[model samples]
Target: MKKSSQPSLLNNSEQKAALPCDHIPIRPGNFVADRIFLAKGSMTTPERVRFVERICALYPEAQLVECPDTPHNRIDLREQDNLARHQKGKHTLVFGEHKSAVRFSAEEGNACPNYWHFSPYGFCFYGCKYCYLAGTPSYWHSPAVRIFLNLEEILERIERVANQANMPTAFYLGKLQDGLALDPLTGFSGVQVPFFAQHKFARQVILTKTGQVEQLLKLDHNQHTILSWSLNPPELSERFEENVPTIAERLEAMKQCAEHGYPVRAIIMPLIPVKGWEKIYGGFVERLLESVPIQRLTLGGICIYQNAKALMEMKLGKGNNISQSLDPRSKIGDGRIRYAQPLRLEMYGHIVRTARKLRPDLELALCLEETKAWKELGIEDRMGHCNCLL
Candidate 1:
């Protein structure tokens, strides 16, 4: 029923081979959609129906189903949770029409000046060992990745919310999902890039671990969007990260975004104090600063709730580096578990010292640490300049 841009005749094998080097591929992302579903309101319009059909076309052999109610309401938690830790993105799925997609974070006590975040999608598909979203009840019930079909309304809601603010505020997209992971398949960036580009008073911030920026490269963004990437060294990645692009690929993608005039930032977060971590991270910082034109670098250690820590234990054994590093005094800060103050200080200090030696003028901030930690690191004044804020 389509005229141009029909489904490709090539099969899965051919498609994988066809993908360019310098990138990693993921199912439930980047064009691999073996399972697809249409929610109650996904196909409300003929145009939307056509768009769904186009997305289905990319996965010619995928099985498509139509859900009667909400996408997660009917899913079984056992299977989805099992997959959450054992095999993420194994059988890629696409759920449609997320009704509640925007919210304001109310994090307090950790020196967090809360910000408004919105998701064009829900539930990231990448398999990271320390994924805090895995513990959330919303994602626990249905671990499938979702794409919202109500963009027009979402944008209108954003306008109303942005209008509430007297000054330009950022609506972040990486809170509940990797902002750009599904972009290669759904082409949502084409919608978001232009929307933020022309919005009256809202600026956009997005983060991802994927290396697919071909869609981003062709857009005409008027500096309204800030592109960020969550990163760890390849050594750490090999041990903890799965079903995502490599660090090299992500840096390459970041470089491309920077050259294309998108403000680029990096969050070297959940820093694991593995054996020889000092050398590994030190060498990596040198390479990162020398290679890319970064606007800012935010450093952080593992921060999560107890429920999420249980999920991490499931994926990684109880004796893992992260689990061993967790502060065991039973004193929780801001309702989230974290590395001890001294350990966090040591890890963050190493990165800060390394970065300062290379580029003293480089902008840096600590992510989700307490005020005292900031004061300890001598970056107390850079508190609100985090990844999500303006």
Candidate 2:
């Protein structure tokens, strides 16, 4: 369980009414769950009550389970064993209290430093085969998709932190899950974007690989929200990102957001070195630049956690390209396996060179790379301004 020490911004009078909970029409096939569960203590709060009412209205046929206790802990050993047996259940949703709603990380050696994120939802609806969450301790323990009901409290904490910073700080929304992947069901974007727009010191950065942006485009964002997309070549998307929107649809969504006066960015991450990758990536970048006015472009290659690497190898088969291409000399740091230093420089350098040549004014950065690697890519000066930051 995670706890935030930051004080709430709400007063007694302000807490009388619940925060906004507006329901929007979900894009078809955006989220389809067979089972829905609520934690026993979830209904004590008004936000949870409204969230439950919204979910019930959206999926009337889903079998709702009121869990006797929190799913993170088990009463006995036998129940824990049963959860281990059913790791692959499809279309399950759990609405619970996010005990650890806000997490602050100061990664000293990486590209994105001094970052904070909150989990309005856990895991993702879109099935990406190489997702790092699958190998994590939390996902291994309880792999079911979860949506938090304490969003109003979470945002209050974020505002307090941003006020303390006394600068134009960013509050990231897509670290633990796809930020907007389940928006069709949750309508979080509709509420969150407007809240950030009203704040004086904070901005919201929402990252997603999913192409659900109808709710976002309708909001009066006032350039306070940065709508970033995780993108890749068409061939890779079709092969790995099952149930996700196509590359064309994602590009169209980015274009639409840009047209709506929102600052847009793209992260071409987990850059797989497939056959003819250069030609594919080059063409994709060309098309992207021509289609949308991107504010920033961040590039990254595969950096998987050790447990996630083992799980991916198991799911993708031992003969998969991801496993076969991993450099044996690459040491594991922060419990993650990375490509060798030389290989990382080659990959990042290639993409950086290709992108800068096409658009010299493009803002480029790396994701989760060390200081030395940043210097090697000639982007060490632009360290803090990453995808999640301004």
Candidate 3:
């Protein structure tokens, strides 16, 4: 079967095109492209042109494929052999997949929740050292922000689904990109929140590591949207996270969201092991209890994709030697790697116990784990969809 070559598309009713500026320089193996769509507020034409021009100059190897002004016929660009090169440690490309409203599930899974992930932007701007996306096919350059203008149609489908389902259905917003990071530029939440707010059966969750909560706070959040934040200890943030918000800032944002009566969840995932991690993580848990009234907390240990194991090992280098020493083996599908099950159980057990003591009513769960682990912890009853239910 021939692979479908549909480029991801978006509604761009608000976008305007600028004249081609100077040619941006690119090294031998880098592929880059940019398009200017109608930005929400105060985005001048010259500024947009300059931003595109600057990026082209920075990545000269990239091809500036211009997208159409009309909703249809937008260019669908693909990386020819650059992905293979990224496999080799050479040049990187910023590949864009312009998806339409009905076609949004890009991950590898048949059981993908029938949720619309309107990824306007292709890659994340924040450079977390342990970012899973970075290890995937997209991390050829400093993550670029690609916005899908056709969000209106995506929301329309969500509404249509909500009308059919009498019971509540949850949809995630930040799966492909930081849900709120691009809100300042796109104002997606302004449109999305109001749309979902009208549907009694629909609940929207926007997750992010960025602390740009002001954009979301401007809207009326009447328990329609749940603003979630991914969290880690200061030690992990400082050592592993790059170009992201501080833990204090994120927690403060959570406090603000909770105060506004919006249900908020915290995800302490990709839990990396380091020296004195127990002590540091314990303190971090204490700080979280003191900071906000968390609606739910999800725990996850490190699960590396097969392709990223080498890159991750190189990135961690000497810092992760301790983790390498206590290697534990487990398999998920055909993928397998080392994450000591005993150690994972021990670490997660501590977190679950501590969090339960801190907030007895706070819902707690794990991200992606086997059912046996839940049974081992004696919390099988709490496991549900995505293991975020309690």
- By TM-score, the best candidate is 2
TM-score between candidate 3 and the true structure: 0.73
Q: Each candidate's lDDT (Cα)?
A: 0.76, 0.74, 0.58
lDDT of 2 by residue, 224-285 (tens): 99989999888988876778888998999899999999999999888877777778888888
Q: Considering summed lDDT, which 10 consecutive residues are worst modelled in model 3? A: 23-32
Top-down lDDT ranking: 1, 2, 3
Model 1 score (lDDT): 0.76
Per-residue C-alpha lDDT of model 3 across residues 313-389, encoded as one tens digit per residue? 55666456334643535655435344677777887888878777888887777666666677777777676644222
When 2 and 3 are scored with TM-score, the better candidate is 2
Ranked candidates (TM-score, high to low): 2, 1, 3
Which is better, 1 or 3, measured by lDDT?
Answer: 1
Q: Write the per-residue lDDT of candidate 1 for residues 135-251, one digit (tens) a residue.
A: 787666566677776765666666667666645779999988889888776677776677677665678999899898887899888889999899998999988988789899999
TM-score of each: 0.88, 0.89, 0.73
TM-score of candidate 2 against the unseen true structure: 0.89
Candidate 1 weakest ten by summed lDDT: 16-25
| Candidate 2: stretches off by over 4 Å | 1-19, 25-28, 45-47, 71-90, 106-111
